[model samples]
Target: MLGIKTVFTEMLGIDYPIIGAPMFLVSYEELAVAVSRAGGLGTIPLPNYRTLADLKKALESIRKATDKPIGVNIHLSGKFPWKEQLALCLDYGVRFFLTALGDPRLIANEVHACGGKVFAGVVSLEQGLRARNCGVDGLVAVGAGGGGHCGSIPALILVPYLKEKVGLPVIAAGGISTGAQMAAAIAVGACAVIVGTRLIATSEARAAQAYKDAVIAAGPEDIVVTDRITGNPASWLAKSIEKVEKQPQLGSKRWLDIWSAGQSVAQVGEIKPAGEIIKDMAREYSEVCRCLKNTLVP
Candidate 1:
């Protein structure tokens, strides 16, 4: 087992400082359990389940699979019954939370009361600072080339910049699919890295087979940021954009069929098990670090 210690790993009690990004439709119980069992923090988004009962069942399944620490993603957008979802997660003893698209203040106190940690997904320094003030434990710096909604800054720049300004445990996200990339992020002050697109192609992902195939076939150039999906700047496959543009009737819900991906899609060669993916990443990260150590100027 490869264990690279970082603030994130110590805080989450996980062996690897890798977090399986809480994807909207792609992440579920099976994927979360696999990633957690492999020593990484796995998370499922609250909106993935249609009802509170469905969410409870998923949580039960994950608990059944692994006793390791896992996370739940809460969308604060007010579009869903997020309050109820948070209550359910708290009742189930879920201690880690990843919040996005709204104010973290609403749930920060509640989560903290239960001795839980909350990490907010942020795209800019402004958001990072606000989240910090809201009492979040960390920030998921979602930069350009990240799947779904993203910021204009690249992860290489955003990670260090957020670490400097916000003074929080920063988790770099975007354009990160390989171990070398993870090593680079850590070198630039990121405490961890959240991987979304790469995991979408994993066998444990709940994404449709065609979605996984599309991710495998895509290159960096094939990804484009557009607001056509949800009226927010989100990265998506160019083919999906074309499909959405052709069918105007489906409206924003077109994303149900049209897939979202990041530039990391270029690195997804095949569908492997989530555990294998994490293991390979950890091994490769160790090798890359060793190689870098040898190349450093004395």
Candidate 2:
């Protein structure tokens, strides 16, 4: 179990606490199933399918691909039809639900009733606390370098703040790509690290090779934040974003125009299978712990 601290593993019904962050379009049932089967929690983005029938088919595909428990990522901005989407998730026997972009309290009860644990996404101390009050099992604090709709705070800062402000398990997000970074997050009170970009570059992802190519070509500086497209400051490839943000920026509602990626793009350099990435992260994490422990008998 890579990065599997007991806190998150038990809550999500997985061997590892490492969660594949919900990426729009890029994260599909195949990707999710791969991660879960590889020992980490895999997440299926709910809106990708668009309709109940499509969602049902996606869920069935996930089941056929892997027996590992999986989660469904829900957007609460009142954009996607969550009612229709959620019913499908329940029918699929999902054990976890991760709510993003809005209040998750209202969604928690439903998930819980279906025997699922809820991991509500939050960008601030206040939002995390609110979700905690709503009985969410955990909080995924998406930070400064996290893909779309990122937070103003840095993950290094957000993890600790969330641990203090809320009683639930805290999963840190942002530019976390290596075990050392994952170790740092855990040392700072994070139960697990939510990895996005690293997984994006993985072979199992549904993104175009060009997208992965862009991530490899980019450095941290290459990722620019522009509300010029999303209204909310989102970090993405500057070259691609420049063109998208310039179209009079008719709001981010036009998701097709802009793409999303986190700053970890600078740290990652190649594309491998999502399961391979998960396996490697887990292996590295264990090595990191072992290397650290070799130092002493205090």
lDDT of each: 0.90, 0.81
What lDDT does model 2 reach?
0.81
TM-score of each: 0.96, 0.91
Task: Write one digit per residue (lDDT tens) for candidate 2, span 197-256.
Answer: 888888788888878888888888888887876587788788776775577556655456
Which lDDT tens digits does candidate 1 get at residues 1-298? 5579999888878999988888989999899889989988999999899998999999888878888888998988868888999998988778889987788888999999998899988899998999999989999999899998888899999999999999989999998888899999999999999999999999889999989999999999999898866799999899977887799998768768878999999899999999888878889999999998899896
* Candidate 2 residue 118 C-alpha distance from true site, Å: 1.3
Query: What are the clashing pairs of model 2?
Result: 203-272
Model 1 has an lDDT value of: 0.90
TM-score of 1: 0.96
